[model samples]
Target: MIVTRFAPSPNGPLHLGHAYAAVVAHDLAYERGGAFRLRIEDIDGARSRPEFVEEFFQDLEWLGLSWDGEAAFQSHRLARYAGAGERLKAMGLLYPCRCTRAEIAAAATEIGPDGPIYPGTCRHRAVAPEGAAWRLDVTAAMNRTGPLEWLDEGAGPQAATPQIFGDVVLLRKDLPASYHLAATLDDAADGITLVTRGMDLFRSSHVHRLLQALLDLPVPVWHHHGLLVEPDGRKLAKRRGSPSLADRRRAGEGGLAIADALRAQRFPAGISLSQALNGTP
Candidate 1:
């Protein structure tokens, strides 16, 4: 059975990019007679809002995307993430770090897809794990599982190189778990067979593949689809005030209609989907 998910962080309204992702996953599963699950990635404790959670359901429904069973919220799965983190710690694959963003940026020489890769400032330090940020020892992890690779439906085979990002935080200091740990653990827990999301997250998959191996979890094929971009080739983001689906709902647009438009490669005025799913000019 092919199982896919449309996991969104409910910190803001669902924009067109989100709708494209949801519809793509939903249609792929629906056509294959598989399961399409919805996951609320509300691990960002400070930014996650109750109103947004309610709005998430409303927007997804409005866009005619139905998820299988109950939606999984990351906030409610802290213990599960902790258990996985502890297991990694016992395996000597994780350690605690106290470096803040400012400290990392100052020391960083190589910038990653997300930001500065940690320079291993705390890897040698004997910092107690409790209440401290935990980072995955990528060097040790890669040593255990040598020469890893994963399949991408669109791009074919990919070599997993997690060391490019150095040590990735698994357990956050403020939040219970970081995105890498929580997402990888939950994907296995949910029995997902296929992972589909924007190509913007393509690099993150490298780290996720390593985590899956280290945790002895199930592996899933991935499809890093092209991102929906503005006509000028800029990525659509909530922070830039992209028009949300809520506003479109108020204007009496149907979810299925928008989904159909997206499927047909048609988009709202002033924005369009990129041709190169891997990279755009």
Candidate 2:
């Protein structure tokens, strides 16, 4: 059976972009007689709030979407993340890094998919500094895994090219796992067969594919759907202060109406769907 999930971080209330992504995942699974699941990505202890989590549940319920089981929380699976990191460390695929973001930015020469590609400053450090984050040795990992590929529902077969991101972080100094590690593990754990998310995250699938190869996790097909963007084409993000679903709900707007409009590709004025690849966006 196909399984899909809507994994959202509870750092803020759900926005229209999140609503669209959730609806896509929910519909894909339900229409095919599969299971839809929810996963709360609350691993960032400092930012994640219980009130926001409750609000997420309320928003999804208000949006007329339901999951098959109780939602999974990343906070409850810290040990599993730590264990995965340890396994990677044992394989000599992870290295500790102490470079701060500002330092990396100053030293970075080339830009990669997720911003400045991290320069391997601490890649060869013999001793790990205090509060060092763990980074995967992408070069060595690729050497071990050899050539890899993953399938996308829309793009079809894609050759995994994780090297583009340089050495990506697997475990953070402040958190047990980064999104790359936790999400890959959680998807496999939840038995997800299809990963439905926005196209903005399309490049992330390459890293996730490499992680699966290293961890021996089950591979799943991905669907990188169009992103909900502003009139200027900037993707709707909580950091930029996009309007939340809770706000609409509190205004006496009908949830089903909003969902139906979204399903029909009828977005609010100034909001449009962008299906183009990274460059065009």
Candidate 3:
């Protein structure tokens, strides 16, 4: 059966961008007679809030996005991430890295898609496992997997280039697993067939495809859709104080009405889905 997921972190309120993403994933599965799953990415214990999680469910319910089966939470899947990380370690692809962000920024020279890439200084260090950040050796893994590729439903066939993100983190000191590790593992666990997400994460798909190969997991087709943006051409983000779905709800907006408006490509004043968007995924 085809499956898709709308995974969100419960660190803040769901904004218009989030609503668009949820609608896309939910509609893709529901319209195709597939399954739509909702997963909570709450690995960051320090930042994740219980109230936010409650609000997330409320917002999704208000948006008319019904998910299949029970919801999955990253906190409940730490052992799975740990097991995968250990397997990568056994393969000699996972290594301990104690480099702080500042230290890495100082050492890094080239800028990749996600800020300055790690300088790989800790790759040779004999760092301990406990309370240490673990990184994946993308180059070493690529050498093992040879040339790899995956399909993007929107962009068609493409080669997987994991080199853009050098030595990506698998596990952080404060968390059992990083976003990369948790997401890759849980998708396989839930049997998600189509990874529906925004195009901003297109580069992330390259790293994820490589992780799938190195971990011996099933690869899924990705649909990297366009992003919703504000009138200023800026992407809606929680950190930027974008209006939350809850805020609109408090103002007495109807859920289905908003969903209909979005379907028509209409957004709140001065906001719109990126003009680069084509047909629905």
Candidate 4:
């Protein structure tokens, strides 16, 4: 059976982009007669809040999206994340780095989808200072990128290779689990056979796949939906006033209105990606 998930970080309110993602995943699972799981990615305890997480459920319900079983929270699964990280470390694919955020920013050049790309400043030099974060040895990870292709429902085929994404951090100085580590490990633990999220996260899938290879986990098919852009073309985020479901209901904009607004937006029908590959679109 195909299993997919909609994991949202509970640091902020759910927005239209989140609704689009949730609805898409829910629809796919419904069509395939599979399972859709909801996971609260609240690993960042400092910023994550119960109120925001509570809002997540309300928002999804308002948008008419439903999932099976009890929702999973990353914060409560540290032991599982640690075990996965330790497995990578045992394979000689992890190292500790004491570089500060400022130091990393000063050395970075390429800007990744997330932010300032890691300069691999600590890869060669092991200055083993106090307060260091653990990093996965991407050089070792590169060897594990086996031949795999994901038939993304929206993004079409995504081919994996070594040069796609460089060495990535599996854990941070202040945080025990980085996004890649927690997400990949949890994806396996949940038995997710499909991953549906935004295209912004699509690039990170390569690194996630590499981690799965190292840990001998099953790779899930992916579907990177188009982002919900604002009227000015900027991608919508929680920071902006993208009316949360609670706010909408308080303002008398019921679930039907929210659903209509989301459904009206032009989303991928899986034709464009195929067209682009065929040099048509």
Candidate 5:
């Protein structure tokens, strides 16, 4: 059985880009007689709001999409993430890092998908400081797992080269798990067979594939679809103050009509699609 999921963070409103992502995931599952699930990625305790989660439900409902069973919440799975981190630590693949963002920016020589690749300032520390972030030793991990590959429905086979990220964070100082650890674990836990998300996360999949290997989690095929962007080529994002689905609903626009238009690639004026795989907006 094919299992797909649309995991959305409840830190902001659902915009057209999110709607498109949901439509793709939902249709890929239902059209193929598979199960489509929804997961609330509310791990950001400071930003995640119950009202936003409620709005997510309302927006997806308005989009005429439904998921199988009750939604999963990342906030409820902190222990699982912590355990995964501990396992990696026990295997000597994780190290506590006390470097701040400013320190990394100052020392970083190469940039990666997520921004400045960590400089490994604390990778050789004899003792970890209090409340330090945990980073994966990507080099050591690759040595253990050797070469790996993952399939993408849109792009076909891809050689997993997670080294580009350079020892990504598995656990943050403020959170039990980073996005990489939490999302990868959640996908495996939910039995997601196909991961359908925007192309901006295409490279993130490389890191995710590595995590899957390290954690002994099931690997899922990925489909990184094109992103919905503005006239200036900027992808619709909550931080950019993009229009939300709620605004459209309040304007009395038909939800099904909006979804149908999106399915047909009939984007609103000034909104276009970008298929760039560089993770740029």
Candidate 6:
């Protein structure tokens, strides 16, 4: 059976962009007569609030999204993430780097949409100083492609020859698990067969796939959908607080109304809320 998951961080309220992602995952699972999973990516514990986490469930339910099995929270699975990091370390795929944001900025050469493009400075460094951050030694990996390859459902497979983020951070100075680590672990643990999310995360797939290869985790199929841009042609952010499911609930709108509104806003043909959830065609 095909399995997919909707993993969202509880750093803020769920906006239209989130709804689009959740709906896509839910609908894909239903269409394949498979399972949908939900995961709370609360790795950034300092910024993830309990209120935001609670609101996430409320919003997903209000928007008619459901999942199989228990909900997984990243904060509670630090050990698992740490284990993966250790495995990567054992493979000589990682090393400690004591570079702060300012320090990295100073060394940064190519900047792109995803912030600083990592320059491989710590690749062959024998030892790192104390209080250093952990980084993936991309070059040490057996298949370190300067550019990576990934498969997307809607757009098919594609490859980028240049590195997206150079020697990206896998672990912080305080040893907190970063999104890349936790997300990769959760995807493998959940046995997810497919991944569907916004195109904004399209680049992250290369890193994730590389990790999968390093750690021998299954690389799920991905579909990077377009975002629900606002009238001004701007994508929604957590701070914007668009007409979320919670807001609609307060306005006395039911699930169907919310679904209709979403569909009216350029949803693909023949896709209904029911189809999105249960695939009852």
Indicate which candidate wins on lDDT: 2
Weakest 10 consecutive residues of candidate 3 by summed lDDT: 272-281
TM-score of each: 0.94, 0.97, 0.94, 0.86, 0.97, 0.86
Predicted candidate 5 versus true structure: per-residue lDDT over 75-188, tens digit per residue: 899889989988998999999898888989999999988789998888887688899889999999999999999999878899999998999988999877888899999999
Give candidate 4 misplaced runs (Cα > 4 Å).
Answer: 109-111, 125-128, 144-148, 162-164, 264-281
RMSD of each candidate? Answer: 2.0, 1.4, 2.6, 4.4, 1.4, 5.8
Ranking by lDDT: 2, 5, 1, 3, 4, 6
- Give the per-residue Cα lDDT of candidate 3 at 224: 82
* Candidate 6 Cα errors over 4 Å, as ranges: 142-149, 160-162, 264-281
Clashing pairs in 5: none
| Tens-digit lDDT string for candidate 4 (1-281) | 98989999888887666777787788788899999999999879689888888788877877788899999988889998888877877777788787776877788887655566677877865454677778776766775654755566665676664334456777777887988888988999899999887766767777787777888888888777677665555567688776566777667766766666556664333212111211110
Per-residue lDDT of 51 in model 2: 89
Q: Looking at model 6, how many pairs of residues clash?
A: 3
Score residue 87 of candidate 2 by CA lDDT: 96
lDDT of 6 by residue, 111-225 (tens): 8546776666676678877877788876566365344567778667767422556788888777477777778888899899998877777777777888877777887888777
Cα lDDT of model 2 by residue, 109-163, tens digit = 9999888999999888877789999999999999999999999999889999998
- What is candidate 3's TM-score against the reference? 0.94
Q: Give lDDT: candidate 2, residue 12.
A: 86
Better of 2 and 5 by lDDT: 2
- Is 3 or 6 the stronger prediction by TM-score? 3
The model with the greater lDDT, 5 or 6, is: 5
- Candidate 3 per-residue lDDT, tens place, 54-134, comes to 888888899888999999988898889889888888898878887788988998998777788998987876657557788
TM-score of 4: 0.86
Query: Which residue pairs in model 1 clash with each other?
Result: none
Candidate 2 error regions (>4 Å): 277-281
